[model samples]
Target: MSTIKLLVTGSTPVTVTTQKVLVARLGDEQSSHLLTFVAGGRSIIVKQTAVRTGTVVVVVSGSPGLIDAELRKAVAKAMVIRSTGR
Candidate 1:
Protein backbone atom coordinates (compact mmCIF):
# COMPACT_ATOMS: atom_id res chain seq x y z
CA MET A 1 0.00 0.00 0.00
CA SER A 2 1.23 3.50 -0.85
CA THR A 3 -0.08 6.99 -0.65
CA ILE A 4 -0.09 9.45 -3.50
CA LYS A 5 -1.43 12.95 -3.99
CA LEU A 6 -3.69 13.10 -7.01
CA LEU A 7 -5.12 16.16 -8.65
CA VAL A 8 -8.66 15.75 -9.91
CA THR A 9 -9.68 18.21 -12.57
CA GLY A 10 -13.24 18.73 -13.58
CA SER A 11 -15.65 21.67 -13.46
CA THR A 12 -13.71 22.60 -10.35
CA PRO A 13 -10.14 21.57 -9.72
CA VAL A 14 -9.34 19.90 -6.42
CA THR A 15 -6.39 18.08 -5.01
CA VAL A 16 -6.52 14.94 -2.87
CA THR A 17 -3.57 14.68 -0.57
CA THR A 18 -3.74 11.60 1.60
CA GLN A 19 -2.47 8.13 2.36
CA LYS A 20 -5.66 6.18 1.77
CA VAL A 21 -4.89 4.78 -1.67
CA LEU A 22 -4.66 0.98 -1.80
CA VAL A 23 -3.47 -1.18 -4.67
CA ALA A 24 -3.53 -4.93 -4.62
CA ARG A 25 -3.80 -7.98 -6.83
CA LEU A 26 -7.18 -9.58 -6.42
CA GLY A 27 -6.48 -13.19 -7.28
CA ASP A 28 -4.13 -15.76 -8.73
CA GLU A 29 -5.42 -14.94 -12.17
CA GLN A 30 -2.95 -12.74 -13.95
CA SER A 31 -3.85 -9.14 -14.52
CA SER A 32 -6.64 -9.23 -11.98
CA HIS A 33 -6.37 -6.56 -9.33
CA LEU A 34 -8.12 -3.90 -7.31
CA LEU A 35 -7.61 -0.23 -6.50
CA THR A 36 -9.37 1.56 -3.70
CA PHE A 37 -9.30 5.22 -2.86
CA VAL A 38 -11.30 7.95 -1.21
CA ALA A 39 -12.91 10.88 -2.92
CA GLY A 40 -15.79 13.18 -2.01
CA GLY A 41 -16.60 11.18 1.13
CA ARG A 42 -16.96 8.05 -0.94
CA SER A 43 -14.88 4.95 -1.48
CA ILE A 44 -13.80 4.40 -5.05
CA ILE A 45 -13.04 0.96 -6.39
CA VAL A 46 -11.25 0.33 -9.66
CA LYS A 47 -11.09 -3.33 -10.57
CA GLN A 48 -9.10 -4.64 -13.50
CA THR A 49 -9.24 -8.17 -14.77
CA ALA A 50 -7.59 -10.01 -17.58
CA VAL A 51 -9.72 -10.64 -20.63
CA ARG A 52 -9.49 -13.49 -23.11
CA THR A 53 -7.78 -11.32 -25.70
CA GLY A 54 -4.85 -10.47 -23.45
CA THR A 55 -6.37 -7.15 -22.53
CA VAL A 56 -7.59 -5.73 -19.24
CA VAL A 57 -11.13 -4.85 -18.24
CA VAL A 58 -11.41 -1.89 -15.92
CA VAL A 59 -14.46 -1.20 -13.80
CA VAL A 60 -14.68 1.94 -11.70
CA SER A 61 -17.25 2.56 -9.02
CA GLY A 62 -18.25 4.99 -6.23
CA SER A 63 -19.01 8.12 -8.25
CA PRO A 64 -19.14 8.74 -11.93
CA GLY A 65 -16.52 11.29 -12.88
CA LEU A 66 -16.15 12.21 -9.26
CA ILE A 67 -12.61 10.87 -9.30
CA ASP A 68 -12.11 13.01 -12.40
CA ALA A 69 -10.03 12.36 -15.51
CA GLU A 70 -6.64 13.27 -14.12
CA LEU A 71 -7.07 11.03 -11.09
CA ARG A 72 -8.18 8.16 -13.26
CA LYS A 73 -5.14 8.58 -15.46
CA ALA A 74 -2.87 8.64 -12.48
CA VAL A 75 -4.44 5.52 -11.06
CA ALA A 76 -4.14 3.69 -14.37
CA LYS A 77 -0.52 4.64 -14.68
CA ALA A 78 0.17 3.50 -11.17
CA MET A 79 -1.55 0.20 -11.80
CA VAL A 80 0.53 -0.38 -14.87
CA ILE A 81 3.67 0.34 -12.96
CA ARG A 82 2.68 -2.06 -10.22
CA SER A 83 1.78 -4.81 -12.66
CA THR A 84 5.07 -4.44 -14.49
CA GLY A 85 6.98 -4.44 -11.19
CA ARG A 86 8.79 -1.30 -12.25
Candidate 2:
Protein backbone atom coordinates (compact mmCIF):
# COMPACT_ATOMS: atom_id res chain seq x y z
CA MET A 1 0.00 0.00 0.00
CA SER A 2 1.08 3.57 -0.69
CA THR A 3 0.08 6.92 0.79
CA ILE A 4 0.26 10.29 -0.87
CA LYS A 5 -0.60 13.62 0.78
CA LEU A 6 -1.77 16.56 -1.31
CA LEU A 7 -0.85 19.85 0.32
CA VAL A 8 -3.09 22.88 -0.11
CA THR A 9 -1.57 26.32 -0.29
CA GLY A 10 -2.55 29.93 -1.16
CA SER A 11 -5.72 31.87 -0.41
CA THR A 12 -8.39 29.36 -1.34
CA PRO A 13 -9.85 27.42 1.55
CA VAL A 14 -8.93 23.79 2.00
CA THR A 15 -12.57 22.82 1.61
CA VAL A 16 -12.74 24.33 -1.85
CA THR A 17 -9.44 22.75 -2.82
CA THR A 18 -10.69 19.32 -1.89
CA GLN A 19 -13.90 19.80 -3.82
CA LYS A 20 -12.04 20.90 -6.90
CA VAL A 21 -9.85 17.82 -6.89
CA LEU A 22 -12.81 15.50 -6.33
CA VAL A 23 -14.73 17.04 -9.17
CA ALA A 24 -11.79 17.19 -11.52
CA ARG A 25 -10.39 13.70 -10.92
CA LEU A 26 -13.04 11.64 -9.19
CA GLY A 27 -15.99 12.18 -11.47
CA ASP A 28 -18.07 9.26 -10.19
CA GLU A 29 -17.95 10.24 -6.54
CA GLN A 30 -20.96 8.93 -4.67
CA SER A 31 -22.39 10.16 -1.38
CA SER A 32 -19.88 7.89 0.29
CA HIS A 33 -17.20 8.85 -2.24
CA LEU A 34 -14.83 6.09 -1.16
CA LEU A 35 -14.73 4.97 -4.76
CA THR A 36 -12.16 2.87 -6.52
CA PHE A 37 -10.52 4.21 -9.63
CA VAL A 38 -8.30 2.52 -12.19
CA ALA A 39 -4.84 3.92 -12.60
CA GLY A 40 -1.85 2.24 -14.20
CA GLY A 41 -4.15 -0.72 -14.75
CA ARG A 42 -4.69 -1.11 -11.04
CA SER A 43 -7.69 -0.31 -8.84
CA ILE A 44 -6.96 2.52 -6.43
CA ILE A 45 -8.97 3.89 -3.54
CA VAL A 46 -9.03 7.65 -3.06
CA LYS A 47 -9.86 8.97 0.38
CA GLN A 48 -10.01 12.58 1.53
CA THR A 49 -11.34 12.47 5.04
CA ALA A 50 -8.93 15.02 6.47
CA VAL A 51 -9.61 18.64 5.66
CA ARG A 52 -7.21 21.04 7.35
CA THR A 53 -6.79 24.81 7.07
CA GLY A 54 -3.65 24.72 4.94
CA THR A 55 -3.74 21.23 3.46
CA VAL A 56 -6.03 18.88 1.56
CA VAL A 57 -4.71 15.39 2.08
CA VAL A 58 -5.84 12.81 -0.51
CA VAL A 59 -4.59 9.39 0.46
CA VAL A 60 -4.33 6.83 -2.33
CA SER A 61 -4.10 3.29 -1.11
CA GLY A 62 -3.75 0.01 -2.90
CA SER A 63 -1.07 -2.38 -4.15
CA PRO A 64 2.47 -1.20 -4.69
CA GLY A 65 3.08 1.55 -7.28
CA LEU A 66 -0.27 3.08 -6.38
CA ILE A 67 -0.46 6.01 -8.79
CA ASP A 68 1.55 7.07 -11.78
CA ALA A 69 3.42 10.32 -12.27
CA GLU A 70 0.78 11.96 -14.49
CA LEU A 71 -2.16 11.50 -12.12
CA ARG A 72 -0.11 12.63 -9.17
CA LYS A 73 1.00 15.72 -11.00
CA ALA A 74 -2.53 16.46 -12.12
CA VAL A 75 -3.91 16.22 -8.58
CA ALA A 76 -1.07 18.31 -7.20
CA LYS A 77 -1.64 20.90 -9.89
CA ALA A 78 -5.33 21.02 -9.07
CA MET A 79 -4.61 21.58 -5.39
CA VAL A 80 -2.07 24.26 -6.14
CA ILE A 81 -4.38 26.05 -8.54
CA ARG A 82 -7.30 25.85 -6.17
CA SER A 83 -5.16 27.21 -3.37
CA THR A 84 -3.72 30.09 -5.40
CA GLY A 85 -7.09 30.84 -7.02
CA ARG A 86 -5.30 31.26 -10.36
lDDT of 1 by residue, 19-76 (tens): 2333344323223334566666666565433322124444444332443434345456
The 10 consecutive residues of candidate 2 with the worst lDDT sum are 14-23
CA-lDDT, candidates in order: 0.45, 0.38
lDDT of 2 at 43: 50
lDDT of 1 at 86: 79
Q: Can you write out model 2's per-residue Cα lDDT over 1-86, one digit (the tens) per residue?
A: 22333334554322211121232333223111233444334554443322222445444433223333334554566577877997
TM-score of each: 0.33, 0.24
Candidate with the greatest lDDT versus the true structure: 1
Which residue ranges in model 1 land beyond 4 Å of their true spot? 10-29, 51-86
Worst 10 residues of 1 by lDDT: 12-21
Each candidate: RMSD = 11.6, 16.8
- Give model 2's TM-score versus the native structure: 0.24
